[model samples]
Target: MTKRTLYLFGSAAPPVFDIARVIEEAQARGWDVCLGLTPAAAEWLADGLDGLAALTGHPVRSRYKRPGEPDVWPTADAILVAPATFNTVNAWALGLTDRFVVGVVAEGIGKNIPIAAMPCVNAAYVRHRAFERSVQELREMGVTVLYGEGGFVPNQPGRREPYPWDRALDAVDGLAPAAE
Candidate 1:
């Protein structure tokens, strides 16, 4: 059987700095990982882009190719949007595709692809009405959102708590598990 592919879409969040380790974890779980990033996230990772591409053996795309261009990455069996920021969450819920990362994830819903999101927001952002609504909207659309107590609990603003990457990966594995 073919190896399951995982498309890891990232936004501009601090945890995105640890993407290399996350990719390694996914690969260790028998996933053929592909990396995609929001424009800001791409800029934040600019220095290590080539190394990341080499690690995944695929181009790290931050924007859509022009018309008639071929796709550089394989179709994903499942998509995980980790370290999802408040902006990303709200935009995705509102069906905004202004960014590449948001575009794929929004379309993933219609494609019936198994999708999961682990948001890396702070306690302050959580207070915004949109955050909860966005989470609810995503859940209503069948997304396995890893948030709240068992998932990515929001930390206080100005504080950088460690993100639970393992929980994010576990959600993805549940969505589309690897070979036995």
Candidate 2:
């Protein structure tokens, strides 16, 4: 059986530290995983980036390939952007592609790719008006945003907990079910 490619993008949230394990779990679930990160995330994970590439057998991309450069990763069959920050979510909804992960997911929307996102923001950020509107906009654009009841619920600022990477992957599997 051919493995479906999953573009697992992330932002610079605390949960992003556990991305290696998340990639392993996704692979176990029959996904050919490809890792993408926001610039800050890439820097945060810099020391481990090479190992992550080896784990996924693909480069951990944080920026667009320059003009005339060949694409390294396979075309994604599905996408999951976990630990999506307030900035990433709003930028993506507003079509601001300055960030690589946001850019790919924004374009993925136009390509009709099955995409799911789980935001890892704090309650303080959630209180801002634009956050809800951005979430609504992404949902309206056909991205399955995993938040609230069944997904990520923001904690108080300065508090960190283990992120729900499993829940996000489950949503992705729902979006693109097995042929079996």
**For candidate 1, lDDT tens digit of each residue in 1-180?**
468999999989999999999999999888999999999999999999999999999999999888899988999999999989999999999999988899999999999999999999999999999999999999999999999988999999999998999999999999997766
* TM-score (all chains, Cα) for each model: 0.98, 0.98
Each model's total of backbone clashes:
0, 0
lDDT scores in order: 0.95, 0.94
Which pairs of residues collide in candidate 1?
none
Q: Candidate 1 — which residues are off by over 4 angstroms?
A: none
Residue pairs in clash, model 2: none
Candidate 2 residue 60 C-alpha distance from true site, Å: 0.5
Error of 1 at 57 (Å): 0.4
